[model samples]
Target chain A: MRLSERELVSLIRRKLARSTASEGTIVGPGDDAAIIAPTPGEALALSTDAIVEDVHFRRRWATGFLLGLKSLLSSISDIFAMGARPRACLVSLGLSTWASPLFVEDLFEGMLKAAGRFGASIVGGNITRSNKLFIDMTVTGHLAPGNAITRAGAKVGDAIYVTGHLGGAALAAKHLFGGRIDRGRLAEVESFLRDDVAATPGDAQVELLSRFFAPPIRAEESSALAAAGICTSMIDISDGIGSDLREVCHESGVGAVIEIDSIPVFDRLPGSLAINRRDMLRLAISGGEDYELLFTVRQSDELRLQRLFQENDLCPITKIGRITPNSEGIVFLDNDGRPSEGFTGFDHFSTKEEGH
Target chain B: MRLSERELVSLIRRKLARSTASEGTIVGPGDDAAIIAPTPGEALALSTDAIVEDVHFRRRWATGFLLGLKSLLSSISDIFAMGARPRACLVSLGLSTWASPLFVEDLFEGMLKAAGRFGASIVGGNITRSNKLFIDMTVTGHLAPGNAITRAGAKVGDAIYVTGHLGGAALAAKHLFGGRIDRGRLAEVESFLRDDVAATPGDAQVELLSRFFAPPIRAEESSALAAAGICTSMIDISDGIGSDLREVCHESGVGAVIEIDSIPVFDRLPGSLAINRRDMLRLAISGGEDYELLFTVRQSDELRLQRLFQENDLCPITKIGRITPNSEGIVFLDNDGRPSEGFTGFDHFSTKEEGH
Candidate 1:
């Protein structure tokens, strides 16, 4: 299990060479740094995100392949959120001595698949020893100048919208973290994900694991939204709505008025937990890891945005709120028009440390 | 000092917003991704490197600033190794809950200083909670198309040369990790580094620590070498001559004959610890973290490369060996021309775990 760093790097290089090499690369893995040609007339978008073993995820909760896939996809999500197509990435991994070379191979295979599906070439990376396993990926993309949709453009009258299901990933995380899944079920789920035969739609455990294991892909819709010039501001819901909403509002100097009942809830949980409707609503509002695009568009462009989404087979968008003056202070009204209170953004990862 | 991730990110944004903003950035921090306008007609060189709490350096040995400075600079060295100018970087930090806000501030100050010195803008990054502190940096640089100096271009008759001192970083690391200094001296060294009063010329302790704390900056030298178009292949000496030479030789499908006596030695140790010449020679060849440039130039271009360095007052280069056909293998010869045996690459960081 004590594989040399050189061997791991060689393995990664071989996997990438066979699968992830793109034309713009002048030099790929095995160099001091990867050299890539920037597309003519396009700017580059850069982002970095890391998955520390216990911080972002627990290894036992998913297979190595699923873990690798999610780690790369999460970073790639940033590029898509910027309305850019991911082109290349550098993955820095810190593997403990207990990890097998096969684990490294499986991990890279997952990353290769994710990059290939998203069109990002595996360009360069570093391998080193650590007491804990961590995957830090930096992904870059091509974007036309001045075309990025940032989180600082929300206007007072713009309507707030989100693509895809909300709070499902968080709910999935809750079941796992809340210790609802037994060891036997965990093994089965991990095996399914490891074998990539995860299509058992009727199994509640597999269904729940899939949501956290694989958030819906949002790159195409983000590109479409940016191209249409309809979204005034955009952000991905990696953190729950409460946190993401605060970011946009704070940056844009705006407040928001959200309709609690209008917000689309991801209620596809695996089993009957007897959770009340109010609890489900709160989960929808506070859960993180959704990877869904949350954006705003001027009222006039709302129709055009809707038509564009309709034309393409993209995730449907829901109008959950509208931007308001900064003085209003992000007000949210319940279905009865009463102020919805005390639902703060829930950062599940930061709340507790898993005892290893 | 369990500051929220939000507050830490806000601190980073404020620091970067005040100091590191570059013109090409359409969006900087506080966004999902940073958008940078790639320099016209230039390819990009991307690299990542990380420093974990105990794996890379002990906090008692150096202040947060030096740790931050070295971490970022080491990554930037890769861009230079490719003969590119550092442009922008994303830093992903995993901080423990007990870490203070002041530590975070000082850390970024160190990174900002390095980035500022090397002309790289702090574009985007993520701050997350971790059981131990780690800083992972991904740096991108600009290089003219087809101008990158890769490690796969060396050929037979190519002269192997290196810039700057070698083995000094490993020697310094040995001193600190071997417990050469007590708590009082460790505190003093940390204070000296924390205050950035690093210019004590004659203090051996300070000098020894300086070598490890602040690696030699080689961006300008690398750019000059690449621009000169003399080096047939190049690599940064992060893992000492032995490991790096293996990289170039393996990639280029060639071998090398090195005169061990001719290799540059970073012999400016603070004071002698009764180390023999043979051991010092081995350390010089096997020690990692030198961050020097090990490269090859054709016999025909050697004079021109030497002339270019002399004209620019650049760090002097030494001709240590010549590339051989793969059948010759990578052989090292001592001053007596006898076959030098058993001086393999020394990977210090990967050798032992530092007990926290």
Candidate 2:
């Protein structure tokens, strides 16, 4: 479900399985987000992504440091989803002619800060001249052997749990539409846009905007859970619960049922960002960029999970749904247990011109 | 030196030294093309490069499969330069809308073929929509303990040797100038380019073009030389002897003297690609992408190197130069043993839109 990828996915999956490069590769592509193994006792996870200007982000919307930090953080989110600890990263910068030395340094500063946070470093990378600024990043992480939580392991009776909150990044992004601003006024108008957004129900302008600027880091919690052998299936919520949830279900060959009333709408962080119940509900379900861990656990181990979180003082996790048979499909129940509609996730392809 | 890069180089070099994340790092940036260590007995080399449409290559000139092949071959060439055998690679594709699924599959075919040649495989990567097709690849290679042949080990009195021939790829490139072709006439005109090129000097259009498509494989020779401990320093001839030789001297605190007459002009492979003596000399010294290993051997090991190659039945290598004191600089001597002029390597930054 990364990039909501098409075509080449299945083709690469079938062809790459037979070709083993290393002696200790426990997992290859198609099922896991990465592939590698240092020893039979340990596994290495590698994932790569190319974030382009306008397509993924806009230079006018965030500082170079924030962009660099976010680029690395969002990429490593997959490593965490696979229940691994980030070790190193390689960044390929496609800089345009107008880019300056100071700007490049700022970009590195952001990446270094993020990498340092998780004991990761920028090992090596390449740079190229391109029409638009592109940050292509590859992150390598390590995990205990047999602990890789692929998206294909969820069982029908598993209880689904989501960590932290969601919907703030999507709301912050809504403030900026499909339009271009004056180049010189980019910085000044960015502040103005923040102020405009602050005038709305989301009074914590800085906090909400941060959701769009950087992804929430969850490696520690994820690794602990993985080491404890808890998660059945897992995926990072980059494209929201709706799109991401569908991915987990499809991969696991199962269906899910969500209790809408149990979902945390992410309002208490800074007060209600949602102006109405409908807006809040839709954002909670379909607004992407939460970067939280959406995972499944055995029904019998629910009490153990609660005790683990409490004992470890980990971030609060909520049981939002349960896994169901594949024929049942993904269902959402209202307070009256009735079905609902109007769920829409971010479509990267259609939003080609839109950047936030 | 990878891109004939600019300002940000030294800045990154100084900052990244203190930020070690892994416990097993034998080397880091500013010295080697890659950075990693799998165990005390073996090292893992990780290097990345981003090749963009038009900026690095032209879609109109070559088919997707060849582009993919060339892209991978060039990147892994760095691994061989560091005295390692490729084990795996992760490719991040930024696909433009015009790119079809068929084109992507062809790309994978090329990469898979190149990877399989060295027992390597395509492991994992991500794809995204972009304004142009960009392949950002990271190659991981392995080598014996303490066999790393970085560019910083050369000393005065070391003999310089180059693998295979030079200038054919550059000469073939000379047939292509800065120009655009009709989109629909691309495939037809590409054959025309080869035909037009064949009519002039290089009769082996297919062979000359192959030099530009797939880089000369030298991992076997490089690894053997490094394992034998005959090389004091080594580098791949990516940006021609002038630029790449300068890099070796600058890093090792030594200089070099190239015997112009000793350089094989790469004619015997399929016939002379160079038109005249002037173009021949210039192409041999300046036009890049030969991808041959340029290594320094101690004067004492010269006989041993000869015996090793002769005994192992390896590719022919020619000794074309000798290392000198730092004050000597990089000098080129003609047949009469006089200093020569008129050498200019490819400037990747200036020819931004000129794809070939």
The best candidate by lDDT is 1
lDDT of 1 by residue, B41-160 (tens): 999989998888777777666566767778887888888988989999899988776568888887888788778887688998987767778889999999888789999999999999
Instruction: Name model 2 segments beyond 4 Å from true.
Output: A1-41, A176-203, A268-274, A350-353, B1-41, B176-203, B268-274, B350-353
Which of the numbered candidates is closest to the native, going by highest DockQ?
Answer: 1
Model 1 lDDT per residue over A283-332, tens place: 66777788888999999999998899999977789999999999998877
Candidate 1 at residue B180, lDDT? Answer: 74
iRMS of candidate 2, one decimal? 13.8
Q: Any runs in candidate 1 off by more than 4 Å, and if so which?
A: A182-204, A272-274, A348-356, B182-200, B272-274, B348-356
For candidate 2, give the docking quality class from DockQ: incorrect
The DockQ figures for the candidates are 0.66, 0.17
Shift in Å, residue A3, candidate 2: 34
Tens digits of per-residue lDDT for model 2 on A1-356?
Answer: 12111222233333333332334332233210122334434555667777788777766664676677778878878778888777657778787665565566557766766676676666556666778889999887777656777777899999999998777777766653333323333344334333331133333655666666565677778977887898888888877888778878877899999988887766744443436656766776777778888999999989889998899888889998999999999998887998767665555555323453
